[model samples]
Target: MICPRCAASLTAKQRNGRMCAQCGKRFALDPAVHGKGMHDIRIRGIAERATDHGRLKITLTQLWYLSRSRNYAWAGRDPQGVPARIRWLVALPVAAALVACAVLTGGVLAVLAGAAACACVVVASSMRHRPGQSPHAQIIPAEQTFRDLMNGSWSAVYGGLPEGVVDDARPVPRPRGANRSGASVPVSPPKAAILCTDRVVALFLTANGIPARLEAVLVEVADADGTKGRPTVLAAALSAIAQYRSGLPVVVLHDADPQGALLAPLIRGAQPDRVVVDAGLPVSAARNRLGVVRLVRHDRLADAEQLRTVAGLPEADAEWLGEGFWSPLAAVTPRVLESIVVRAVERALAAPRPTHHEALTHGFLTWPQAPRSPRTSRAPGTRPPGTGTYKKKGTSSA
Candidate 1:
């Protein structure tokens, strides 16, 4: 809790009456409000918005366990019971005095005895004891029970999460230059890549073998002059700087919302010839029809109007988003989404087919399919219709 007067951290010890150390003012805390709730109302509100309260709460509880487990193994500021120099300071003087005394008496053994005794005592006491817990230990474990309550909420929402996504979600250190799953990015850049708006979705896709990066999907890309049509976004911004100048096929995957609906246009601008596919979130029908487990929020996004104006969403889909509702990208499982994205890129890179529309598109024009030779396509005994094989004036036959 913050001090109403000066915003310093207030503790339970000073709950009733406390003085603000910074401003030197006294204030009272409300027992009913401060640090009091089954779950913090702010978080609970976000969780309950999509009828996913129980599941999110359980995740919060798992988060709590991970946090508390960290507390149990946390280290302290001070790491020694006493100063290490104290023992040396005490013994060095005593050893010097004994050697001085022995010099006056002309005794060699006495000097050696004093030096050895001092050395023994110094070695024994010089090792400082390990430090204890921090002064904040009193409040560190206070939320243990809250975590328990969250765990007991009985939510099955994790079924929608991709395997290993939740485990990797925990904030633990990974090897430098490696991603959350301890895998370094491939040396050869993928032929094409997938970009996601949310960091969580990016991490999930990257962990599951879809070459992806954490790139935000904005509702619209603003210009240097802050204009709409001349907008700039990640892929488009990179292209202007000659990044995807070779025309790399960029696939965009995002949540179902106004901001996501306009993601492709934002990346490709008015009209682009690149193989950038806007494989954004599916419509409500497609999501349900495909049995995609995603969380739908009956709320509005800040950029709802921008999407309706210029996103070019099909009529039925635009109507749904205009009514103010959305879904999180995590609603689609990582494996499911990854498979879809990989297949989309593969088809884009696959052999030219009879359909041939996309086969000729997306930078495959230069690498045209080889034309078949006359010998290869014809049967062994057959020849072109106009050329009869080895004519010899009817071969002087019959």
Candidate 2:
């Protein structure tokens, strides 16, 4: 491990107290104390990459995935089998015991003992190991374990979390007069909305001011009950926004699981008049992608069956979901995730507004003509053209 404070390679002895012997500077996250590959320098590097060098803010969940040792699925056969050496060790002991018995006992007794020993050796040599049970298998650490390391040890040593990394597990304080039902109160009426299935992703966007920059409301969908009912808060907000600003577009950002696959369709079904863009993590994006975390849950078999009903879901993706595979949006790097969302919002805004009898139509034909430049003189007989200003939205645009 290299000392984060001094840039000097540190031996276990030198970093025994989490202090560098060279500069005598203290640092958090000794690899020995935390899991392998979790030194302070590596943690900082992961945070930097995840946050795009402080240009974006990421949540602890994103940091956890970025810091994982293995992000892709295990290929080929399971690597948890007992070693040949261990099998040989067991076999050798049994063989030696059998040889001793054969030498000490009479003919029939000796033969039976030898046969039993041979069977024992065969069984030992053929012992099958369970998947993910090997000591060498790179299991993902539990979220709580990673959180404890970051919040407890790392904070105690470094004073706080790394820059641009927010702890999503911590409860956000509700503003005064906030709704008790967990619906977020928008500071102002929004032109668009981002509906995220995961609270962590929503929190990441909110922390980084993505919603504010897009002039969009951020709505986090709570875990669904079996009823599969539409979220009333989302419905009310959309209705109210549409009354003031017609054709309010929505961007649905979600994971690559069955529930996520169903979210966009559910919203579209409930609000057929609104434009809902699905900017979610698809199964194809994470299926064979390098360095993306693909998790498995055996309990999602029923959920996978339900995904077949979702419109436009590929058969392969449906089968993958049926097999209980999922990938969280939080697993995406902060910069890339932000880019995807911004592009999706642009698409939503560019989509033609839903037509209503009372609403005035706005399109290429009906758009206002460009105004003459201030420097250009207007004809005396012609009325002054309307002064139209056009501003292009960028990633940093407010």
Candidate 3:
């Protein structure tokens, strides 16, 4: 057992004297015990914490193993000085002397004599070897065990990390001089062309052999200043029309709502006559008819009576109805959207082309559907200020 005072190993004589050899600390055994139950109480507490006290004590013994392992591997500072570098100091001089002696006397005997001298020098050097001044001995195997323990513990800790916690969410790189998807695309076509605001609508038209471009301008205006009984949103609708008349007629595929009406003028330029067509018209009448209509609306507003009669539909149904038309859907429904798209295309095909600015500006009138802030609808893939309520899902709130 190690001495409690100096932590030094106790000798037989030292134990007999009940004192530490290194520190000279005295020890005594208690003569009067508190009670026999004291040992039982201590044993009970120890048993509650551990299945086997001997096992626990043996584990605690590893502290010595750890320290000893470290001691053998690590060199402690020397109290005095480091061991002298004897190998180089002695070997070189001896080798040089032996070589010189061999060179001076060239013969078998002289070479034999040099060889003997070299052997003697090696032996003498080995005899004069000085022990290192460092107090600790190298602990090789023990240090290795400690290192293994540390590595295993760290491995266990690292293996316990949760998956998908840290992702490298880098932005996708687009190609140079191309659209965001990296596809080479043409700019908007002429005013006489049949264009669309939604890509899906354009794709559908293109598939059906219609000459349609996506995101084509339907309107352009100087400003959004106040103008009579119409809501402020009418300006955007008028703008869509102006854009259309400047070149091609457009097919606006949007939600069946007030704001969705803005897209109509954008597709077909405003005409001198405010003529609007719908799917209710005979296919022959709508077909090849060169005019514009707010076709996507569930109901049209011809006057204040019509305007007051209009109301928003169920969000689910509105979205479901929106899907019948082709690409870039702001709505989600699958009913009658195709027919509405076809009617718009037929009307646009039949409309007369605008040649003058006045003609382009003529029948232009704004119908307020949903008054999206100019800021909110600046461009796709952008979030404008105060546009939070209208998300990709297409629901609006105060």
Query: Which candidate leads in TM-score?
Result: 2
Task: Give the Cα error of residue 52 in candidate 3, in Å.
Answer: 71
For model 3, the stretches where C-alpha displacement exceeds 4 angstroms are 1-188, 191-232, 240-247, 260-270, 273-343, 352-398
Candidate 3 per-residue lDDT over residues 35-146, each given as its tens digit:
1211212322332333232222111112212222112112223243323465556666777777788878888967886897788567655554435443222332343443
What local lDDT does model 2 show for residue 171?
A: 54
Per-prediction TM-score: 0.39, 0.65, 0.23
Residues 1-398 of candidate 1 have per-residue lDDT tens digits of 56556566756555443455666665432334333322233333334442233322123322332222112111124566656576667766776776666666656777676677667576757577665544221222245553433333212212232222133335423323445443334445545555556555544443333353322111212222212222334555445424433445655666666656666665555335555555666544322232222222333443435655667555655755555444445544333455555555664444223221321222111111333322466568964332221322110110
In terms of lDDT, model 3 sits at: 0.33
- Deviation of model 1 at 198, angstroms: 1.9
Q: Considering every candidate listed, which one attains the maximal lDDT?
A: 2
TM-score of 3: 0.23
Model 1 TM-score (2 dp): 0.39
Residue ranges of candidate 2 with Cα displaced over 4 Å? 71-139, 172-188, 224-246, 301-306, 354-398
Compared with the true structure, what per-residue lDDT tens digits does model 2 show for residues 217-309?
Answer: 767664544234334434643454454444678887777777666666756665667777778786665554445577665445334446677
The per-prediction tally of clashing pairs is: 1, 0, 46
Clashes of 3: 46
**lDDT of all the models against the reference?**
0.43, 0.66, 0.33
